[model samples]
Target: MSQGKQLPEFENEDDLAAWIESHDTSEYMDQMIEATDEIEVLRTRFSTKPLDVRLRTEYLEAIEELAERRGLPYQALVQRWLLERLTQEAPDLMTK
Candidate 1:
């Protein structure tokens, strides 16, 4: 067994993710403080980064049309569709 170190304050999920990628969960899981009382969170937000990709203009226009019908921004529609596809084809990608 390895000695566990104190977990640091994470600024965001991305920061915590970077730490997890380099550290073994077993090494730190045991060091966590036990919950003595109920904890409540007021809000939840996901951190996102800008991703630029080139696509065929026709496909982009079609996406825009579909998004418009759904009253959503094209980018949001694309993200939703991509997430749905990833869930089916590559769930591991979602976790990472």
Candidate 2:
């Protein structure tokens, strides 16, 4: 690769991963590790917002039951359901 040359934009996560691997020398690998760690920290920091939700026992039970039926943890199911609802209700929130 030439100095000052720019790589093309990766279209998806898989493409990005492949590009990173292809570019991996010892120095570039270290940079990739640091970049991945920083990305994880960014994801955690952004997802750290507090939510004070109040759900009735019946609703909670329903969620648990649905989660059990889907073989997913209750919290995972609840989070996915809430995400779906928010996405449907306010589609532009994700774009922002």
Candidate 3:
């Protein structure tokens, strides 16, 4: 590998991502390290399971229209509404 310039230290993943997005990674090829170490991957807190709920066509259409106006998927809007209601009703249950 060529003696390329050293990589800059980033405070967080966002900074590293921004740097990589703006710069040519080819220059940092020599500074990169192989991922041989075994790392534990933790499950995400927002992991979701498939839910099957039957809703009336009119309600579904209204939800789809609202979600479209808000630039979000209908299911995501529904999830957000549900979470919001849950938080309002029982804030303790919503705690991580």
- Give TM-scores for every candidate, taking all chains together and pairing residue i with residue i: 0.51, 0.44, 0.52
Each model's backbone clash number? 0, 0, 0
Tens digits of per-residue lDDT for model 3, 1-96: 677688899999999999999999988888888879998999777666999999999999999999999999999999999999999999998867
Candidate 1 residue-wise lDDT, 5-88, digit = tens: 766789998998998899777757766666699788788687889999999999999999999999999999999988999899
Candidate 2 on 15-86: residue-level lDDT in tens? 988877787354433233343443334433354466778899999899889999999998888778888999
* Model 3 bad stretches (over 4 Å): 1-45
| Candidate 2 accuracy as TM-score | 0.44
Q: Report the lDDT of model 3 for residue 80.
A: 97
lDDT of 2: 0.72
Measured with C-alpha atoms, the lDDT of residue 20 in candidate 1 is 86
Q: List CA RMSD, all candidates.
A: 13.1, 9.6, 7.6
